[model samples]
Target chain A: MQDDAKLIEFIKTDLARGKVTGKLGANDDLIETEILDSLGIMKLILFLENNYAVKISDEDLTLENFTSIMSINSLIQRKRAAQGA
Target chain B: MDFSFTDTQVLQRESIVEFARRELNDKVRENDQAGGFPLENWRKCADMGLLSLLTPEIYGGLGEDLVTTANSLEALSYGCEDSGLVHAIVTQLCCIVLINLYGSPAQKERYLPELSSGGMIAAQSITEPDAGSDVLSMRTRIEGDGAGWLLSGGKVFISNGPLADIIIVFARCGAGKSAFGEISCFLVEKTAAGYSMGKPLQKMGLRTLQNCEMFFDSVGVGEEMLLGKNGHGMFIFNEGIEWERALMTAAHLGTLERVLGKSISYVKTRKQFGKEIGKNQSLSNKIGTMKLNLELGKLILYKMAWLKDQGKRATLEASLGKLFVSESLKSACLDAIQIHGGYGYMQECDLERDLRDSVAATIYSGTSEMQRNIIARMLGI
Candidate 1:
């Protein structure tokens, strides 16, 4: 949960880019709500790879891993843990 | 940062060009006129190891890098007079690269050796009656069976459909989700029951490359045949298309170079008003523009290839390169024909054929409009 706020801020600021109204929840369905398109997903992957230094392979590109800010945060934390181990 | 080819790469390119010229150019006119796929020429390309350029050595391939593979494709297109043949070869290469990238270990062990050696042909079937640019709208359906899947749908405009021994078919696996999670692909063999192919479709250009419609009626495929994970078809497709858009247009680079060379030679030798036509500023300017486009096109293509070789993403670069090279190649082809005058219109002159073939470049591997949309999206517009 350390990076949840950072992940949410990045999605709202960088990806949504003022498209979201009021507040974007951490558990909001990114795909179902159309907040993150295919290109947005690609950009998110690039951001996680560059900012977090966690390499995401094709297998990690599932809908479950990218469904929400919380899910994405979990993915990054898991990748970081794996790297540290 | 260094852009020069290595000594070995330079020699390898030369040998490939020479081999293509000797073996692939035979009866090209006849083959194109008949709209026939040249099986003999395909076998020659396989024997020359052209088919195995990018497959890893573990799978009976040369294990060449992306730059080398692009270089060889450029050389092959330059020396071969048959644009259709070059297109077919590039299509196979795209499928091979896709399988290499996403195939399971068991799938690789079963398919790579034969595909790499050109002992079998493969096609990627994604387009449907209603789906061309809008892939998410495709209606092909795959339903889960006991331990397998039942595929039922039809695909149109499949490049190697007529002759492919195995086809990678994308189908809808679920509903009420985004394209990223709704689509799945399966590897279906030609011998599968209830699978059938329509006759080759007639086309104005690239006539020798056969394109056809395919149908699958409850064709059963084991779960093992599913490529990658379920719901990952769109991702797999996007990844594979980057390679296709980049390297397939590498062949267009060769076509552009050949057209520029021919235009230059004709202008220098052909006389108009008692002087060489090269003396005409208007005509010379066209040739000059052709040269400029070819050079710029090469730079974009190589940059994309270099990005892929470095294990970096090149989605935007690939779209930009595809758009630029495809449009410029069409312009170059037309200029070559115009510069050649009446003689160029003749089928024997071959510039007309090049022009006909160039039209498809803008239309396939994602259209020019789609490329622009991708570029805009990448720019966050």
Candidate 2:
């Protein structure tokens, strides 16, 4: 599995109970697919912050930044670059 | 555990108490009877900087932490006889705080300064007719437009609805999203073409605060109006509820003190059977219980507020605090009325209105039953 897949798996396992309910695709929108309800999204945000050591600021909380696993991974990469990680 | 307030907090509390006592209590009985919200008092509170306690200083706010906000609200409630007006203030302030936390920079630029300065009133639109406690079951929908969204639905029991300039409306979206998944929060201005408000709904208590039903019939909102990202309504709404439950009832803490003081004074002075009512054990025991509830409720509320200030999620603590303080306020009001005997029931004593207002504490920001459900879930029950 790819590194991005690992994060997707984490979200899937915690929020969707490891079930691929057609909403866990790599490019599927977590908010749009209903896989991550509001509370689930919050939990996922915390999960990414804690596991990856990246801060998700309010400006980064938009749909363009968090729509899918790909977007989330890209955001993390950008944040890491910004921090010179 | 240290429960001491900082000197700054103490001074803030004192000034708020003084202001409320001097400016807010006038003609309260007449206003309550007329169901009139005194706009002057609302602006007075704004001028005192009470309107902007939680927003950042750059946005024209006092930017106080949660504990200080709670302390100031408690002092205001203690001094102010107008609980309805305070209720309106909390509703508007809660909306402002949520917007500050979630609004885009542009959205903030448009609304925050006016909201913080009390030049504009804010209200949150939730609690539909079929979806009060079952918030996820709301039927309001937001369909994607070319560069915006079209909202169509109705919201009931909207606090400050009639007077609000901007309303944070929650609506459904997404094709196959779960009930919770499809919801999104939108910023709907009252001037929107299809947006309209019903007349204020008269109530038994908090009469001076205006509440109404709102309708959005294909109201168009640009991308700038979304408070947070789409499908994140519940999270944003939850944030507000958490703060509201944790701190808004700080006023009730003050109300409890007021009721207790009044009861004590009445018991000490009023003579019955050739002696003061304090000579009676039952009445004195009632007072004792009121005191007990006051102390315990304060500790819970203070802890919850402090946790919020530390930027921690205190869902359990907030629920517990809201549950305790609201119920305690009701009981204290009842005891005060009982202690005052027939006179308490009369509008002249104000205990009747206090009791009426205290009853609503169990209903909004999640009912007592819902709070217990949250607590039980947190306990993994």
- Best-fitting candidate, measured by TM-score? 1
Which candidate ranks first by DockQ, i.e. highest?
1
Per-residue C-alpha lDDT of model 2 across residues B1-381, encoded as one tens digit per residue: 788999998998899999999999989999999998899999999999998998789998988888889888899899998888999999988988888888889888889999988899999898999988666778889998549899999999998999999999988876454433467898988899999999999998999999999999999989888877777677677778889886667988988988999999999999999999988999999999999998998898888888778776667788899998999999999999999999999999999999999999888888999889777644434
**Chain A: TM-score in each candidate?**
0.89, 0.84
Candidate 2 regions exceeding 4 Å error are A1-85, B175-181
With a 3 Å backbone cut-off (N, CA, C), the pairs that clash in candidate 2 are none
Model 1 residue pairs with clashes: none
* Interface RMSD score of each model: 2.2, 5.0
Fnat per candidate: 0.27, 0.18
| Poorest lDDT segment (10 consecutive residues) of candidate 2 chain B | B174-183
As for model 1, its CA RMSD to the true structure in angstroms is 1.9
What's the CA error at residue B329 for candidate 1, in Å? 0.3
